[model samples]
Target: MKIFKITGEFFLAVLKRTAFSFLDLMKIIVPVYTMMTILSYTPVIKFLADWLKPAMKIFGLPGESALALILGNFINLYAAIGVMPLLHLTPWQTTTIALMLLTSHSQLLETSVFFKLKTRAIFLLILRLSVAIMVGLLLALR
Candidate 1:
């Protein structure tokens, strides 16, 4: 009887934590997805797609991918992921973006930390971006 009660309590706690986590994720993903959907109906997405196409192609990604990269670098991976489903990217493209973003995500926050350390923040920023581009290119070629 005691074991059953403990097990039930544990499961209740797990359920509560899961629900909270889901809500937190939805808070970020929902807004970004909504905004991306709205932009799709306007020329803004098209304009950005066209503007970024050439540069993005070098990494084997669509122009729409630039939004994800920007959001991932400046905001967080959740924001980038929120834009991904709308992009209809290929598996390879998804993999490449995941790798690139994982390599150099959260630049603004991390750059400030680097500055506080009295390091050459600009150099580190350039290095991370360069590495991200290189990783994207390498995955794209494969």
Candidate 2:
């Protein structure tokens, strides 16, 4: 009776919330994925790879690995993973990228979250990116 009505309302609320959250995630993921796909077809990715090759060499990764790092940092780890196979990275390179992403991925999303918490987004971004690069450099030395 009353219990059933309350349960139904609760379930409906949960469903609505879930749907909205999914939409929010899709808003971020789909556009980035499409852009990355288009970039793959263009020479832009190649140019970026060449431009970043020297920096990437420090991490023992191919120049193309820059795409993964850029996607991971600006978009999200899932976006980076989606772009990864296209680059045909080695196992070591994959591991290095994974570690870097672990330290600093989803910059826009996480920065917004941090901002809502009254924290300095730029500081957090710099800290995470610096730590990620340092870890990559250390791993490359091994």
Candidate 3:
């Protein structure tokens, strides 16, 4: 029947589209996953995490979260995105932490890319953390 033929074609088309979408997702995800794995083992991550502890303490985030925050701040937002699977943060905690990071993510890189005005990167970093911690504290209180 023509109706049956049309339905079969539609089903096959949907299946083909789904498979291609999954393949595209894998292509994008694989490199980021690999990079995150390599970055996890790097001493730089450890050092930055340690460097951020006292400040991160104000928001009650673990040092490992600080590593993600710092990477997100200085590198690219994808840095934080890539690290999330490796982190042990709960969904709520992850959202809170990620929001904080995104509030000032990759300022230096982004500023340079946009050719914006120059300012002390450290000053901005501290201000961003202060705001993030305040928001985090408010969320915790709620």
- Identify the candidate with maximal TM-score: 1
Query: What is the Å distance of residue 128 in model 3 from its true position?
Result: 4.3
| Candidate 1 residue lDDT tens string, 7-36 | 999999999999998888788889999999
Model 2, global lDDT = 0.87
TM-score each candidate: 0.84, 0.71, 0.56
- Candidates arranged by lDDT, highest first: 1, 2, 3
Of candidates 3 and 2, the better by TM-score: 2
Which lDDT value does model 3 have at 114? 45
Q: What are the per-residue Cα lDDT tens digits for candidate 2 across 2-33?
A: 99999999999999999998887677667766
Minimum summed lDDT over a 10-residue window in model 2 is located at 24-33
Candidate no. 1 TM-score:
0.84
Where is model 3 more than 4 Å wrong at Cα?
A: 1-32, 35-54, 113-129
Clashing pairs in 1: none
Candidate 1: misplaced stretches above 4 Å?
A: 1-6, 113-124
Ranking by TM-score: 1, 2, 3
Candidate lDDT (C-alpha), each: 0.93, 0.87, 0.71
State in Å the error of residue 1, model 3.
26
